[model samples]
Target: MENSVIKFHHCEKDIYCFFVPEQCPVCGESLSSRRLQEAPVSIPSPFVNGQKIKCSFLVKPTKGTFLREYDGRSDLHVGITNTKGVVYNYNETGVCRDEQGWAQSVSVPLVQPDMYSLINQWDPYLEQFSLAEMWNPQRYNETDHNCYTYALTFINCVLATQGKRNLTKTEFTEKFVLPRTKKASRYITLYQEISENYFYIVDSSQQEDDNSSI
Candidate 1:
């Protein structure tokens, strides 16, 4: 990412690989210094003690990451956060996923920070989970019984306390997880190409007619 170049696709229309070009790649519009940079990105606050971001489930790479801004398959680890931003994730050995290492984690905001803090029962339910299936490490299986199961179980527990219906894996993944991951994957691939070439361009018209995830 030298000079941090990333190609800017203009709203799924034409290709615009303006490395500060003199004119706009489309419409033959003139370029200005300020507009050429696009808009600057605002970084969010850190996850620690950030109730809004951490009140829901969080996902990060299982091991050291690379541009893994997010992805929820085998390479990713999921966790639930307390109102105070303490993450509780499960693994084969134990439930201290954070004790390992993480560069960054993207959170899913299914659970609300205010809702969790408003209930006096929330903390108790979290503590009680320690006595559940995770109590026996032998039950751990990377594919079947894993961190995702633990997090989803806690979500259902909270729903029960709130008198809401349970959520299935299909709905949770297709509705929530995939949307966020697509954005991350697109960002990563775009960056990878730009880092090498210092510029990238895409034209929707040039692409084949097909359905594909980022």
Candidate 2:
């Protein structure tokens, strides 16, 4: 069965508060309260000097219009973030680095602190893989051995080091990749839905705060 997306309402400062049908999850109260329960402790690390350190796997819609012609459909790009918050994604050009964005992401809890090292080690290999693909179109099929596969390979390698069984391509796509991509797509749709409605006005006062964080 397909996974269902979690429903939430935008709260103060754009924080998402989970909802259960007509009721709020926190306070066991009505949704009108708008007060959130203490934010769940983050998975990566607790706030250090008021800064949250996070390492995650992100599934972002491909940027720009140029590459869309290749697949004739919107494609998802998968990447992993380092503890330093840098994102590493494999693309036609090779592995690219960028700062984290407000995209769909899943926290990847490190079994050991050294797992971060394992992620970094894949960078060179991914670059090599991409280079080989550039020389041969058949090396990486757009639908099969693409960015999603690249990210999955890296994730499976990390899991293997932790004595966990590696995930098959089908298992990885069905269990992790597809679910996260669907959630991200739904989030974009929900945001547009809310934006078109007149009742859910965002406070202009928080614009600066939001931009700064981004």
Candidate 3:
């Protein structure tokens, strides 16, 4: 499959292409080389041991009228990704409605070095919290139980592991509220602040200082 080549159909023209697999292993859909074409990509398995892992907070836009008109937000989805590059979010399957659709729109990396360690440590806790419901489509709710809440919960877990304070509901709203709402400016500002504070790489010296103090 790795050596196979694919030809793209673009504007009624066939173009030679290479590198990508001929078909998706999971969905068995034909792969296309066209820039506009969307196809599913495989997610690599998670690392088995406590190796260095990077997690990113992601936001994906929604195209549904019900989502936009009713929710009043273009930022429809939120999720997290590890170094293996698999996104974990709460949403319906095929939410993107495209072959290659997954949270590819916007992303911000977590700042802490022990992010993966915390994830491994919190596995049992998450399970008890009904982590399986995250994958259940029927359990999704727009207000009380949504992708935003899922992401915020995960972030809070990570923060707890670091001895950091948890974000309140109001604070979470201010930081990640839908951009189309009346608090657009405040949302933008708080989003920038959280992104910069929680997503950037920490200095080695600072990290050492933190660890030593702890």
Candidate 4:
């Protein structure tokens, strides 16, 4: 999914990243047209003391627009991005890189910026783990040992290198992965309802705005 939050100046600029919301969330200014960002690519980092850091990310296609172009099992092909954003994934063709298409991704930023050596070694470690014998193409299973398996295992390897606890399938899914998918699902549902009815007002008397996000 695209970024839903942004910084806005009272005076607009020249380029926009996503859909122009009716009003600016920051200044409460009405946006008739050209709700642009002056520095669209200069988004400030929220991690590592506001410095841009290379992070490992989990990626999956969010939803198809008109034509549903995706995997054969009607399931998404999951991939892990290296420090350079090169997507590595397993398929019938075995461990590969840069093959998976664009996806909605969530970054795994457990590694701190201070661990420079470990951060620098992410790519090689990931490459070594991905090439292991268990990830052979003939061993691939659409249901059982598949791309998701490769992603989790590789992540655990990286964690082990950093002397951290390996996340169980339950922990990884519940803690990191599912939360994002579920929240995105909620926003999509909300957007659809608003499109159909022009509004989706919540019961403010009973329940406050759902301020929490994944």
Candidate 5:
């Protein structure tokens, strides 16, 4: 079955990668508008000094829009533009509305480390599958893996959400999956099991006592 969620991968430079199709592959009909079926939510990383990011969910294009348009399109035309212009194939400019309002413009961001890639939606199945391939440093390419593309996509989303209150674990799971859980777990297993490696809790009371002692 097709994904009910309109997938968006975060990237650097304030860009989100979304899938959009131009015409029906089966019937070849022009597709119409799309809408987010679920509210946008985010996962926060505790290690990164607190960061909140959005999730992926179902999208309902205006009635009459064919599902085929979104199926095989590589153009990234994912969301409806504020101008309401016709959503183009492979278009990244249109598909970003985080449950608040339509966004006007979009751009992709630059991510470093180049190892762990992230997706907005968490698929338990993907974890196992991706692990099978594992991240081969030699095989890394921006054009190849969906992991890189989506990680790049979400990096932009993270940059967009910076300066906001970090999301709680509940918020993170409800919204997006923690990036690089599988591989990182091998290195940081202790951190993952306890807090999902999302946040670092600070004891304010202890800090005050320590200050008094000093």
Candidate 6:
């Protein structure tokens, strides 16, 4: 596949594409791209590992040819891929109807930790969902399904409040270091200093003269 030229289908949506490697392209973090493809049902990396942002929404089949069927199961699975390249999966059950189509839905979630802060900025009382269903199994049986109605939108908002979004090492230290030092105060003396280009921490064992900038 590496040697083969890749093609993308034109999407009206502004899509961000990434070329994932054997390891995290950023932060030099070790990753297993191979494992994802090899799994019986491939679970994307961001979902299983460190910090990921996610959101889910439902989709109803309104027009023609909006539904699909699988060979073995009476149910269907709703899945989505986020900007960070993680995939979220939900299993749904549905039944076919005589008319007005089947009431089916898909929950679409995105993995964007920064979005939580932005969402709160928009609405303080917005409902937060913990787990979401992406597909309906009732309408997924033998016949064609259409005109689905999605119930909710769930997003993982915890990551944002926990300060897991985009951050530099310096910024992270400034935001989280003080509290850590305070909590460890009983065990050791933690002195800290920050300058325009230097930041350092001193232990109780360090002599005053030994404490100096890098």
lDDT of 6 at 47: 14
lDDT of 5: 0.28
Query: What lDDT would each prediction earn against the true structure?
Result: 0.59, 0.47, 0.46, 0.57, 0.28, 0.28
List runs of model 4 lying over 4 Å from the truth.
1-54, 62-74, 206-214
Candidate rank order under TM-score: 1, 4, 2, 3, 6, 5
For candidate 3, what is the total of clashing residue pairs? 1
Question: Using Cα atoms with residue i matched to residue i, what is each candidate's TM-score against the true structure?
Answer: 0.68, 0.49, 0.42, 0.63, 0.16, 0.18
Better structure of 2 and 3 per TM-score: 2
Cα lDDT of model 4 by residue, 1-214, tens digit? 3333222233432222234457654456776645443433332322121112245555444344211232322455567766776777788889878633444344455467688887788888888888789999999988889888888887788778668889988998888877655665554544444445543334332222455321
| Candidate 6 worst ten-residue window by lDDT | 1-10
TM-score of 6: 0.18
How would you encode candidate 6's per-residue C-alpha lDDT over 39-93 as one tens digit per residue? 2122121112111322332232223212233122233323222333233333233
Residue 141, candidate 6: Cα error in Å is 7.4
Of 1 and 3, the candidate ahead on TM-score is 1
Evaluate candidate 5 by giving its C-alpha RMSD to the native, one decimal: 23.2
Which parts of model 1 have CA positions greater than 4 angstroms off? Answer: 1-52, 66-74, 97-100, 113-121, 203-214
Clashing pairs in 2: none
Better of 4 and 6 by lDDT: 4
Clashes of each: 0, 0, 1, 0, 26, 19
Clashing pairs in 1: none
Error of 5 at 65 (Å): 4.9
Give the candidate number with the greatest lDDT: 1
Candidate number of the best TM-score: 1
- Give model 4's TM-score versus the native structure: 0.63
Worst-scoring 10-residue span by lDDT in model 4: 44-53
